[model samples]
Target: MDTAISPELATKAERDDLLTLGVEEEYLLVDAVEPRAAEAVDAVFAEVPGELRDGVQHEYYRTQIEVASPPQLELDELAAALLRLRSGVAAAAERAGVRLVAVGTAPATGQNARIVDNERYHRMRQRFGDLSPGQGMCGTHVHVSIPDPETGVRVLNHLRPWLPVLQAATANSPLFGGRDTGYASWRSMMWERWPTVGPTPYLRSHEHYLTLIGDLEASGAMLDAGMLYWYARLSATYPTVEIRMGDVMPTADDAVLLAALARALVGTLLHEVRAGIEAPDVEHPLLMAAHWRAAHDGLEGLNIDMATREPRPAWRLLRQLFDYVRPELERHGDLATVTALMGRLHEHGTGAARQRAMLASGASVGDVVDELARATRGEPGNPPID
Candidate 1:
């Protein structure tokens, strides 16, 4: 398995950041009585319109389903596509007597749930047996296309430090397996367990990246380029830097704000690269530390500087990030919407905070589940999508 990325190939790859955007969202397929990842995506797939069928796929578990947005240029277009996809999935679930809940982790499954029997998943289960089943967690994946491979790698490196910021902003899972996990984004914790996951190492050159990939492959740590699973990484299939830290947001507006910020971050980094400005490098350990804080504390904890090794309040850093990307948001015509939504998130708290607040007021897990269902269906009492 001499899977080394060639220097020539890296050099030939474009490094500019183009403004293409794509999104992938994971949903929990729950039985009417038990909220778990349902193994019925194929059945749900049958109900989706042919145009959207291509983007819908089964996840690791039969209980989970994923929908991907087509490559879109405008933010509004992405929002509309996701909405339509959500509606279609919800309709399918209703007809099947199941429900699709949008959260980072499912709350009803016990420890004995069975894994789906598929070649790839079976291989994963055989290799990493216990950890494999936990992969049922849901998330929101944002893809921003970079024109070249080197720039893709560079943008990934530069964007590494901010992954935690995005994760904290979109943190939505405060419960797992029907109990409070006491973490804002339990999905981050669930994912960090896999080998070659989380933030990528800072590679000084394309050759270095090739060396790292080859070494990991040779060690059998990763099966292919797709397994690198960094919090932010260059996608093997698309010329994009994929940000995979965000939890599945409760409302479409949160999704849009997240997408807007992700695009702006990637766009800003590309601008810096073209101008020959050096991007800041944060160490992997520092990134891990920030991620831990994000999962456990959400916006309530202080973020540590990966380079400086000091703590700063997460709220302050978030404000700084919003200010930093304001120009790009404005350019995309999403600034006003992003601003208002972000303000609401800060004022009222993230979905996790709201969920916990509801529970504290004597709502059961069933109550929260009902709330999520209502929210997913765009019911009148739920938060309005932008």
Candidate 2:
């Protein structure tokens, strides 16, 4: 992999225009011994340290908790904050007599998640019907600062084709109902059952982007702008391009890897916009197929190459993505970190693969869940895969 910075960027001083980024990682609360999803979010939240409470919040379901990092300009700072918050939250779950596991979905058999006691959540359940109970699926969202809606929408266009590769790198949910689902990220498959969760359509301009959001809401396909769960979108509340393609990673380091790539991708797209480069007009159907393939295979098998419309080794496509964003990674002082993390991903495999390995090695589903809980707390007993 040739990751050298191009000569034009090399001659200039390292660009001072690094984008600010933040991460939101959702975690599942499970029984410490039985491996079932635990309805202990309220209990756990009460135990969170005062200093870390702001970053901790409840998810759509009581079985999950979400941690949001403050916007940061540096990757190391983000890493430190995420680690501190994750460790703190894990401690709180322990105090609450439950375990926090970062798997993408509940792995135990015959477990059902209950909605939190929020009016809006109840409305969602009433309207969405059967889809509400499966809301326990967890994902990681990366928000990278953008200058304006126009640039953010364009970045979404450029980001469309690469979303599957990102999803493949973060495919962590392989077990559910006490068995391997034969899919890398079953949470993604479950998520796509929602009306508005798939690839973002090609936008002609910023106006077109706004128009579509309104249309989707008016047509009842989405309840609100918040429900526009496209793989990438301009955040409704934040002035950032949000990438919602990956699963909740197993470790803080894994989340950091995702943030690094997402920020670099945005930076690369901003440069392209300035240089008058047009975003690719990738087909929507092909994009959807790619996402399915990614959730099925992860990095251990083949992924659809959008450019060739043929299957390629997922890792090679990942390399291509890394190469495409190399200049931005180099400019932002993230090259070494990304390189090392990617190596770690290569050696350890995705969380789904690791979980399956444990299951195959005579460990029961409950044992796997216990190990994941220990890994979530960064304890010495379990090796890290993030």
Candidate 3:
């Protein structure tokens, strides 16, 4: 628990605008009756108001819808925006005769997801068939402000191992194809099927980043620069570094906690760069292995140690992760919320754990969606998670 940051950064004038952040979450639209995936995203969009219509968009699957929050300085402001987005989307979906559920994957699976009628989506399904149909998954993405691409590259390089910690913290997909997958986040495994996905190969410089992405696009494996699905990347459309590793957390409060950690990680990495601290030289394969362990095990099992790149208890890795960002979190006045979230992590476990616990108590897959749908709109749920 060192709250110490680089003295060089301490002396620099603090900018009120340094910590801007935004969150994007995708959700599955399900039939209200049997809790099966439903292809009603267009109908729901029609019900949305013209003012908030632009913020919601169609996903790869017609059953999936995405909502994005405007950039906000404080975590509370971001949470408020997300709540409104979720409620609006949920109300629209309800009116459209489908329920909006925010689990990482559809609980009552086995049916193929209907593909949206878009040219880009058509190409994706044509190129990657089975993967596209089973891709009825959702994830919570956070974007933290980075001054420029140079700093973004540095932050991404420093963020490799810790990305798994984010995975461990937000594991939510436990059921796939209507059966227990025995993995915390099956959505993470589904994402790996894409050609240009997973850990970026430590692009140390902005020039290096372009070369890496350029080679992938040239190879025809990825159709465009946007298809390079690194868990973390410099945003193509914004002055921010995007963390795309987490599943859609069950509640808006949980999503805000993930966003706060993302901002703290960015701030800490920027300060590390200023302090002349180099990112650890863990190989890309090792980094991929770490991500696998985290996605498979979540907080209830072992995680790869960032310093040594070896197996260790998940709690140990999680603790070390917080210590690295404690300084940045304190500076942003987010330490209290993060600390309380850690407590909830232990009590309620991850969303994946809660899903399984409900099943263990004889709740069916449909019942799991019932619990998830309620929590999706920031409503109170059983076991009373904070």
Best by lDDT: 2
Candidate 2 residue-wise lDDT at 313: 97
Tell me which of candidates 1 and 3 scores higher on TM-score: 3
Return the lDDT, model 3, position 201.
Answer: 71
lDDT of each: 0.75, 0.86, 0.83
Q: Estimate each model's TM-score.
A: 0.90, 0.94, 0.94
Q: 9-36 in candidate 2: lDDT tens per residue?
A: 3333235556778898999999867888
Candidate 2: regions farther than 4 A off? 1-15, 382-386
Per-residue accuracy of model 1 over 1-386 as CA lDDT, tens digit each: 11122344344333332376778888877777655555666677677677677778777787778888877666777778788888888888877778888888876555544555678777777776676454268889888877778877777777877778788888888888788998998887878788887777776766777788888888887776767777887777776778987889877767877888899888888888888877677766778889889888788677765556788888777877888888877776778878887888787677788778878888777778778876765554534221
Worst 10 residues of 1 by lDDT: 1-10
Model 1 misplaced stretches (Cα beyond 4 Å):
1-18, 109-111, 305-308, 382-386
* Best-to-worst ranking by lDDT: 2, 3, 1
Range of the 10 consecutive residues with the lowest summed lDDT in candidate 2? 1-10
